[model samples]
Structure formats: C-alpha cells, structure tokens
Target: MDQVPGSPQEPQDARGDDGLPGCYRHPDRPTGIRCTRCDRPICPECMVSASVGFQCPDCVRGGSGTGHAPRASVPRTIAGGTIAANPRLITMILMGINIAVFIAMTLDDGRLLGDLVMLGRTPPGYLPEGVAEGQWYRLVTAMFLHQQFAHIAFNMLSLWWLGPPLEAALGRLRFIALYLLAGLGGSALSYLLAAPSQPSLGASGAIFGLLGATAVLLRRLNYDMKPVLILLGLNLAFTFLWPHIAWQAHVGGLIVGAAVAFGMVHAPRDRRTLVQAATCAVALLAIAAVVWVRTLQLVG
Candidate 1:
C-alpha cells in the first residue's frame, strides 16, 4: 500500500514487515516510515525523502509558511493613572469663555473699557492720552478683550486645538495658571513694544504661549512636533506681514509658556507638578511688577 503527499497517518489495518504505516518515499508496495517534517504516518509512495529523513510535500515544496508575529498595542494610562490623560475638555472650556467674552465686547457700548480691562491696555500707562489715572485695573481685564470676530476666532481656534494636550500633561490647575500667566506675559510684552500712544488688545499673546507650551512638552515627552512647528511658523509669518498685529505679545507668551512647560516636564518626577506650578507663579509676578510700575507711572 502507498500513501499520498500531505495526508495524515492513521493506524494501518494491515501492517508492513516493520510494523509501520506505508510511506510514498519508496517505490515498494509497502514501506512504513514517518515524514520528518510533519511526523505523520505515511506509506512508501507518499513519503518525500529528504537528506535526513522523509519530508512532507507541504514542507518539501514550501507551499505553506509560518506567519510573522504581530506587534503589541500601547497601554492607555501613564504611571499616574490620569483618566484619558489628556486635557481636551479644559481646552474647550477656556475657548468657550474667550468666545463669550468676545461676543460681549462686540455687543457692549463701553468698547474702550472692554479694551482696557479685557486686554490689559492701560491708556494712561502706555498710550498716555487716556482720561484717568486710576484705571490701571484694565491691565488684567484687557487680556479678555478681542477687537474683532477674526481676532477671537483665530485665538480660540488655536487654543481649542493646542490646549487639551497641555492641560492633560500639566493637569487642570497648572494648565490654568500657565494660561493666565502667559496672557499677562504677552500683555506686558505688548506694553513694552507699543508706542506711548498706541492701544493694543487681543488674546493672540496667550494663544502664542500655548504654542510655546506645546513645543516644550512635545520635546520633553519625545513626541513628534513637525505639524505644530509648521503652524507656528505660518502664524509668525502672518504677524510680520500684518502691521497692526501685536508681535510683542506673541513673543512674550511663547517665552513664558516654554518656561512654564520646561518647569513642569523636566522637574524631578517627585516634585515636577509643584515646580511647574511655581514657574507659572513666577511668570505672573514678573508681569505684576510691570503692571505695578505702569500704574505708578500713570498716577504720577
């Protein structure tokens, strides 16, 4: 009896001289031999003789092969167990607030006051031609003002896209602190750059800080930032082309944001969160000093 190639061996009803199933490797009517490749019982006719022993037809011709191993998936959480571990929700909320304020500024009759308080544009300090000395409170307020729909729309869109990842990395409180500090930093920079009589207002500075934060965090986390760098470049180019644009605020915010992100991402793992927060506090104080000096100058 002879067996066919690639067939599994079964117990022979009639055994050969060696008491084994017949394999096809031999031309004899009966020769019991096991295929070395599959280890299956074969008759002499089915066996494909290899150098060491008989190989199965599938192994001999290489008709079938073992598949490559699949890659493992990445885990969801970091060591800290942060849920979803990204601050997208926080980003949306901040964008919403900015948009709402912009709408209010558009609707309100007291446009100049909105510019002063929401954008920190103190006319007496920077512009010198404004009415009163006691109106320095606008330094903090002016950060929230936007002169046009396009201005707020652009800033909020940037914030919406960039804010969540940073908020997630820094956590909620630190994210908020960095944002406010960045705004103040931008306003201070604008004050420094603007002529004594020019009024400046907008959230672009704060949004620029978010870009800075993104750059620093991505670098520290070993994340790729090709897309973000391109976006930042485009915005900067636009700033240079547009004369009314406040380049000072954007630069200031970027520097402060980078500093804040560095403190957060690179501080000792045990003390990183606290250190990042302190960095924001320091930025705020620096801006506060500017506000204080400007106020005194206005008062005099």
Candidate 2:
C-alpha cells in the first residue's frame, strides 16, 4: 500500500496537496507524523508512542525512562542512516564472496573465469557469449571474478582499507549501493570502450569507486584532501602506464562513486531520502542508456 499522510487524527484535509514526505527509516512509506524530538517524519512501525506525540526509533532508544524525550544524541551516520554495531559487515561479506569466487575459479580452472569475465561480444568463431549476445550478466559477475592472485590481493587490501570507513560513514545499505553502482559503472564503460573480445575482470573499478568516495567524504568532513588526491593521481598514472589495466573502469567508477557520495552526504535534510534515491536512479539510468547505445553498436 502506498503511504500517504493523513489519518483520522492527521487527516488529508491538512496536507493540502503538498509533496509527500517519506519516512526517514522506510523511504517508500509516506507518513505525516513527525517525531516530537528530532522532527523527522516517521511511519507507524518506526513510531513509538511518547508522553506527548510519537517518537522515532532513535529518539525512543536514546530517551530516558522518565517518559521524557531523549536528550542524548541519536545514533546516525554522516549520511543519516542508522549506525550498525559492526560497521564492516557488508565489506566482510563482499570480501568473502570475492574470495570464494576466486577459490572456485582456481579449483575449476579458467572455466568459471571464462563465464564470469566481462565481454562485449564474442568474435565470429567463438560461441554465442557476452552482452551483445544477450549474456549481460557478465557485466555484474565480472566485477567479482578474479583469476590472478595479485589482482585479488590488491583489490582485497584496498577494500579492507577503504570499505570499513565508508561503511561506517554511509551505513551498510548506502555503502553497498555505492560499491555496486561504481562497479557497474566500471563494467559499463569497459564494455563500451574495450573490443568485444577483450575479456576483463576485477574489483579495481569498485575499489577506485571507494577511493573516490573516500576523497569526497574526507573533503565533506573537512579533513585533509592531499593524501587521497595524491593517491588518486598515482593510481591514474599507473592505470595509464600499466599494461592490461582497463582505465575506463577506474575513471567511470570514480566519477559515479564520487557523484553518488556527494548526493548522499550533501542532500538537504528535508529532502535527503528523495535526493539520494534520485541520485542513484540518475546514475543507473545513465548506465542503462550507455549499455543500450553500446548494445546497438555491437549488434548492428
């Protein structure tokens, strides 16, 4: 059911065609009841009955037992998402998946890699494969696939270093969204630019996305930007100079990640959820358009 503001107590007559405000916890659900303490809009599920009005989960949790609203600070991340006890949970799961996939690739030889690696369109002699031939899944799988030791090691190390902090700051959901979108951005660009038969795979694009996000977050928090900028510069240099590196992936992921993180952290408090969703939607739509155009080129 669509959540719209107004109940018998909080009737539709009061809303007067105003834009629906999403519940801070569940953005899809619309609600009119604002928390007595934080003033964040809340759905019935997240609303706890206070002495006067409903309180949000955070307020209830932080509030003292005297039925008074919380004086303590709510546990929320920089991006306004609830902080998790284990900040690195998503990162750990992602690393596990990558490691498991790597082990599978090792045990099964290049068979898994052949299927999972990113390919645009197979050459004439090759079997029907790649995105042009309707095997678009290669784009998603490729980011997690790795056949080489050094490749996985570098990416995993980068993930270990960068993933936890971003996860802590952005919260798990936003962090994962940023990571996947960044990887997909990388994959899409690689597909668009690389030759059809040019097989590529790695989490470097995702890593680079995190790198870009780290820089953005650092700058947003008023931290020194020189370290990340210098690191980005060095990586860019290596990407161009090194053989077998798909620089397109790095560039694409960085752009998308930084853009998404910007929206996540910088959205106006009143419109944070909508703005964040819109930002991700825009990035996805852009990638989809790129994929469509490239598909036409490859098949035509």
Q: Name the candidate that leads on TM-score.
A: 2
Model 1 Cα RMSD, 1 decimal:
21.3
Model 2 C-alpha lDDT versus the unseen true structure: 0.80
Tell me the TM-score of each prediction against the true structure.
0.64, 0.77
Worst 10 residues of 1 by lDDT: 72-81
lDDT of candidate 1 vs native? Answer: 0.61
Q: Write the per-residue lDDT of candidate 1 for residues 5-111, one digit (tens) a residue.
A: 44444333545554544444332324445556556554322333333444444444553323332221221111111323344677777777777777776678755
The CA lDDT at 299 in model 2 is 87
Across 4-63, the per-residue lDDT of candidate 2 in tens digits comes to 333212423222134656676556646666777767776544544444555665665656
Q: lDDT of model 1 at residue 64? A: 33
Cα error, residue 219 of model 2, in Å, equals 1.0
